[model samples]
Target: MMKTFLIYAYSAILVLGSLPQLRQAKKIPDQPFARKAKSIYRTPATVSRRVIEKTKSTVTVSGHEKIPDQPVLFVANHQGIFDILVLLAYLDKPIAFIAKREIKRIPIISKWMEQIKCVFIDRSNRRAAIKVIDDGVESIKAGQSMVIFPEGTRSKGTNVQPFKSGSLRLGTRAEVPIVPITINGTYKMLEEDGGRIKAADIELIVGDPIYPEQYQGIKHNQLASDIQEIIINSID
Candidate 1:
C-alpha cells in the first residue's frame, strides 16, 4: 500500500513539475497541427512511461507496426486506468482518446487532454454525445488518430464486455480505418488489489485495420460483434 502511495505521489509531482512544458505550445506561433500535436504529446508521453515504470509492471506489445500512418480509429477494450498509461507510453503516433465528460474536471490532467484533442462524451445527454462524435470526426480529419473503448466502461480486466455500437461511428463516419486492440492483465495491477497497486505483466495486441470500404453496408452492431470476437480471440 505504501508503495502505491509513493508511486502516485511521484506521479503528482511529475505532472506538477512538468506543467511548464505547456508554455512550449506557443514556441512555433504559427505551427501546423502536426507540430502542435507533438508539443501536446511530449510531456504526457514521458509521464506515462514514468508511471508504468514506477508501477513495476511490464507491458508486452505485438504487431504495433501494423498501425498505419494515416489517421485511424483505435477500438480497444477498456481494462482500467493503466490501459491509458500503456497506450500513451507505447503507441508510436499521436493519439487522443474519447473519454467520459467527468474526467475533464481532473486538475492538470484534463488541461493536457484538451490540448491533445480528446473528446469528452456526456452519455446522459444525447445532443452532447452527438456533438462529441462530431468533434471526434473533425479531429481525425485534421490529422490525429483517436481511440475508442467501445465497451463504454472499463471491465477491470475481466471477460470483455459487449461493445456499444455508437462509439464505432467516429471511425466509420470519418471513413478512416478501424484498428482492433486487445488488452489483457491490466486488472491485476490495481483493481485486483482492491485499489492498491501491484506489479503484473500486461499483453497488448494490435489487430489489423478494418477499412470502411470493406463493410459498406454492414450494420453497426454486427460490426461491433465482429471486432469483439477479434479482441476476445487475441487475449491470452
Candidate 2:
C-alpha cells in the first residue's frame, strides 16, 4: 500500500541523512566510545519516532521509571518487527540489541546498529553462538545496555513463546540487572495485516528489575521461564 511504501521510503531517507552523524560518532576513542554512543542514539530514536508517527500509530508506555541507572539486560517478547522501532522510539534509556547475524548484512542500518554496540549471533553454528554470548557479555560489562528477545524470533501475535535459556547468559555473565519488558500490539502495526502498515495502539510495560542477587543462583532455564511468564502476564 501507499502508506507502507511511504513509511519505508521516509525511513530510508532518515537513515541516509544520519550518515554524517554516524561518521562523527565513530571518531570517539574506544575507551569512551560507549558513553559517547548514547548521544548518537538520539538520531535513530528520532527517526524511529517519525516513522511510527508516519503510520499514525500510538505507543503507551508504563513503568519507565523502573529502569535502573546502571546498564542492564532487557529481556522482552518479540511480537513483530515494529517491536524494535517502538523500543527505540520510546524507551528513555539508550540500548543495543542482540540481533541475528543476517541483520548485519543490512546497509546503513547495520552500520548504525554497530555504532550502538549491537551484538550479532549466528544461531546456526554452536561455537559462533557461544562467541556471540561472550561478545554480548563484554559489551554489557563495558556499560552498554542490551536487549534480547528470548523467543529468538517474532511470534507475530500476542501469544508469548517459550524463551531460549542460553540467551540469559548475557545478563548472568555480566552480573547486571535483568529487566523484563512486555511489548503488546506491535504485531497489529505490520505483521497482523500481512506486512501492510496500519494504525495501531501499542503498549510497552517495564517490569521490575530482577537484580544480580535475585537471579545469581537460579538456573538460566528457570530464569528464562520466570521472565517469560512475567512478560506474558503483563500483556493486555
Candidate 3:
C-alpha cells in the first residue's frame, strides 16, 4: 500500500510539475526564437536546474555529426515519452515531431507543438493521414527535419516492434535521406503500460544515412523493415 501510494504521489507530481511549463509554452509564438526559448533553452544542460532535477537519467549520443545538413526524415524506435524530452535536451538541431491529432487537444503542449510546426496525423482518417504526410514532405523540402516513430506507439520493452510503412513513404516521396536512430533505455524511464517513472540511463546511437537511391525498386514495407533492423541493431 505504501509503495502504491508513493507511486501515485510521484505520478501526480510529475504531471503537475509539467503543467506550468506547458502553460508557459502556450503563450509563446510559433517563431524560431520562441521555439529556441521554449525547446532549446530548457534543454538538457539547464533542465536539472529548471525542470526535472532527476539528472540521474543521463543520456549519451553518437553519430550526430553524420546527420545531413539538409532536411531528412529521422525514423527512430519508440520507447516512451522520455524519448522526446531526451532528444530535445541533447540534439543540437531544431527538429519537429509527427504527433497524433489527439495531442493537439492538450491545452499548452498542443499549442507548443503547433507553434513549432509539428505535424499532426489523424490515423483514424485515411485522408488526413495522407495530407499529414504531404505536409511533412513539404516541411522537409523547406529544410525542417522531422522525427517520427515508425512503430506508431511506445514499444513498452527493449525490443522494437514492426514499423508502419505509411510514414516511410514521406521519405521516399520527398527524396529525402532516411536517418535511422536507436533509442535505448527510455522505456525504463517511463513505460507507457505503467504510470510510474524511474531514473534510468539513456543512449541514442544514430546510424549512417540511407538514401532512397539505395532502396531503389524496393517495396515500401521492406524499406521500413530494413530501417527498423538498422535501428534495432544499433540499440544493443
Candidate 4:
C-alpha cells in the first residue's frame, strides 16, 4: 500500500511541476497548431506513461495499422480512467477527446485540455450538446482527429453498453472516417483492484475505419450501432 501511495504522490508532483512549462506552451506566439498541440500534450503523455509503468500494467495494441493517415474519428469503449492513459501512451496518432463538461472546471488541467483541442459537452443541456458536436465537427473538418466514447460514460466492467448513435454525427458530418476501437482489462487496473494500482494485461484493438461515404444512404444511428458491434467483437 505504501508503494502504491508513493507512486501516486510522485505522479502528483510531476503533474504539478509541469504547470510552468504548460503556461509557456500556452504563451508561444504564432506557432503552428500541431506544434502547440504537441507542447500541450507532451507533459500529460509523460505523466500517463509513468503512471502506467508505476502500476505495472502491460498494454497490447493491435490493428492500429488500420488507422488512416488523415485525421479520423476514434469511436472507442470507455472502461475506466486507464482507458485514457492507455490511449495517451500508446496510440500513434495525435488526437483530442470529447469529455464531460464538469472536467473543464479544473483550472490548469482544463487549460491543457482546451489547448489540446478537447471538446467538453454539457450532456444535460440538449442545445448545448448539439453545439459541442458542431464544434467537434469543425475540428475534424480542420484536419484534427478526435475521440468520442459513444457509450457516454465508462462501463467500468466487461459489458459494453449500447451506444448513443447521435454522437457519430461528428464523423459523418465532418466527412472523416470513424475508427471503432475496443479496450479490455482496464477496469482491472483500478475498479477491480480495490481502488489501487496493480499489474494488469490490457488490450486496445483498433478496427477498420467506417468512411462517411459508406453511410451515404444509411441512417447515422445505424452507423453508430454497427460500429458499436464492431467494438464489442474486438474486445478480448
Candidate 5:
C-alpha cells in the first residue's frame, strides 16, 4: 500500500517538475514541433521507467524492431492503466495516444499529453468523436505516431476484448501502416489487486505491421476483428 502511494506521489512530482520544459517545448514552431516533442518524450519515458521499477516489476518486450520508420497507428489490447506506462517506458520511439476526453481533465498530466499531441475523444458524442478521428488522422499524416486501445476499456485480465472498428479510421484515413501490439500482465500490477500495486512480470509483443496496401479493401469491422484475434493469440 505504501509503495503504491509513493509511486503516485513520485509521478505527481515528476509531472509537476516538468512544467517549465513542457511550456518551452510548446513554443516551438509547427514545422519543428515533432522533433522538439520527440526530445521531450525522454522525460516522460524516464519517469515511466522509474515508476515501473518502483513497483518491482519486470517487463519482457519482443519484436519491437518490427516498428516501421514512418508514423504508423499502433493498435494494442487494453489490459490496465499500466499498459500506457509500459509502452511509454519501453518503446524506442516517441508516440502519442488517442485517449478518452475525461483524461483531459487531469491537471499537469493533461498539459504534458497535449505537448505530445494526444487526441482526446468524447465517446458519448458522435459528432465530436468523428472530429477526434479526423484530428488523429491529420496528426498521423503530419508525422506523429499515435496509439489507440480499440477495446475502449481495460479488460483487467488476459481475455482480450473486441475492438471498436471506428478507431481504425486513424490508420485507414491516414493511409499509414497499422501495427498490432499485445500487452499481457499489466492488470496484475494494479487492477488485479483492487488498486494495490504488486510485482508482476509483463509481456509486450509487437506483431508485424499491416500495411495500407494489405488492408486497403477490407471493411473496418473485419479489420478490427482480425487485429483483435492477433492480440488474443499472442497472449500465453
Candidate 6:
C-alpha cells in the first residue's frame, strides 16, 4: 500500500508542478510547445501499458481495419481513466483525445496531452464548450483524429448512461466520420467504490464508423441516442 500511495503521490506532485507550463499553453494555444508537451508523456503512457499488461490484462480489439488512414472522429464510452491508455496501447495510429480542462493541470502528462493535440473542454461554461468544439473542428480539418467520451464523465458501471447531445456537436460540425468504440471492464479496474485503482483485463471493441454527412441536420438528441445505441451494441 505504501508503494502504491507513493507512486500516486509522486505523480500528483509531478502534475501539480507543471501548472506554470499549462497556464502558458492555455494562453498561447497556437504555440508549438502547447502541443509538443503532450508527446513527452507518451514515454510514461507507454510504461503504463507495461504496468497493465504485467497485471495480466487482456485486450481484444476489433474493426481496426475500418479505421481509415484518412482522419475521422473517434467516439467512445468513458468508463475509467484506463480507457485512454488501453486505446493508446492498442491503436497504432497517432491520435489525440478531447479531455476535461482539469486534466491540463496535471504535471508532465498535461504537456504530453497538449503536445499530442488533445482538446480540453470546460463544460461548466456553455460558451467555452462551443469554443472548444470550434477548436476541435479545426484540429480535425488539420488532419488529426480525435477521441471523445460522449458520456461526459466516467460511468463507473455496466449501464450505459444517456448520451449528451451537446458533446456530439463537435463531430457533426467537423463533418468527420464518427467511430463508435465500446470499452468494457475499465470501470471494474478502477471502481468507484473507493479511490483504489485495481488491475484487471479490459475489453475494447470498435464498431463500424458513422459518417457525419449521413446525419447532417439530425437533432442533437437523436444523434446522441443513435450513437449511444451503436456503442452499446458494440459492447455486447
Write candidate 2's Cα lDDT for 62-134 as tens digits: 9999999989999999999999999999997788998889998999899989888898878789999899899
Local error of candidate 5 at 224, Å? 0.8
Full-model lDDT, candidate 2: 0.90
Please, what is the whole-model Cα lDDT of each candidate in the order they appear?
A: 0.87, 0.90, 0.73, 0.83, 0.90, 0.72
Error of 1 at 39 (Å): 3.6
**Per-residue accuracy of model 3 over 40-96 as CA lDDT, tens digit each:** 335222342222235256778899998987777888998887788777667666677
Score candidate 5 by lDDT: 0.90
lDDT of 5 by residue, 185-219 (tens): 99999999999999999999999999999999999
Which prediction has more favorable TM-score, 2 or 3? 2
**Per-residue lDDT of candidate 1, residues 1-236 (tens digit):** 89999999999999997778866654544246666786678788899989998988998999999998789999999898899988898776788999889999999888888778899988899999999999999888887889999898889866899999998888889999999999888888899879999898998899999998876789999999999999999984
The CA-based lDDT of model 1 is what?
0.87
Q: lDDT winner between 2 and 3, please give it.
A: 2
Candidate maximizing TM-score: 2
Give the clashing residue pairs of candidate 1, or none: none
What is the C-alpha lDDT profile of model 6 across 67-160, one tens digit per residue?
8766677878988877887887776555778888998886567676766678898879889888888888877776667788878878887678
Candidate 2, residue 229: the lDDT equals: 92
The clash tally of candidate 3 reads: 0
- Mark the regions of model 2 whose C-alpha exceeds 4 Å error after superposition: none
The C-alpha stretches of model 5 lying farther than 4 A from their native spots are none
Estimate the TM-score of every prediction.
0.95, 0.97, 0.79, 0.92, 0.97, 0.80
Winner of 3 and 4 under lDDT: 4
